[model samples]
Target: MKTLLNVLLRLIETARILGLNYRDLKNAEDLLMHNEFGLCFDTIITQMYEYEIEIDDELYESISKIGDIMNLKPESYTFMKELIRDESNIPKPLKDELTRIITSLIE
Candidate 1:
């Protein structure tokens, strides 16, 4: 239940970042039935590529804790490492923010 709640929160946050309103999730069940679960993280990565935004500490900690508890596979870990390290076009402040977040995860 806790995991589900976290995933749902991430889904809602993703929609919000995509400039979506509540109505966008009105048909969520059907909509999500056809989408990849990993797309949520991919969306975050893509958004980071375009522009950085604050990720609340709680949310970041939730993600990091989940990853740590799960002992995520090497491939998944590599994927995350790649996503966070992709600072190609981000502004300095956002880049620094990402660096901090990634660094936290590293430790």
Candidate 2:
């Protein structure tokens, strides 16, 4: 389960880094279920933050407004903090990308 979740998380993050939008996420979700990831709709919000990818205000608002329709939940901000603290579990490519993204954001 953990490995599956990790892979889903990694794919979503990779898609985001490649500039995929929510629609892309939807497509990815279709593919994700086929894998052993065991991801539920509720997990997407948490996964978004886990990747340190930010959604704009309008997108965030939209996510909040229609989350139920999409079967997602409002993820707790603390999820990000916890995810960020667990670097040892992340893949090297993802870790490198995240570091690049964070560095660019800071600069």
Top lDDT hit: 2
Off by over 4 Å in 1: 1-11, 14-31, 65-107
- Give each model's whole-structure lDDT: 0.48, 0.51
RMSD of 1: 11.2
Question: What is candidate 2's TM-score against the reference?
Answer: 0.33
Tens digit of per-residue lDDT, candidate 2, span 2-26: 5445545665665466455676577
lDDT of 1 by residue, 1-107 (tens): 35644574565565476444444444443344445334444444344334433344354455555445445444442333333333345645666879999999999
Name the best candidate (by TM-score). Answer: 1
Q: In model 1, how many backbone clashes occur?
A: 0
Query: Number of clashing pairs, model 2?
Result: 0
| Candidate 2 CA-lDDT value | 0.51
- Give the clashing pairs for model 2: none
For every model shown, what is its TM-score relative to the native structure? 0.37, 0.33
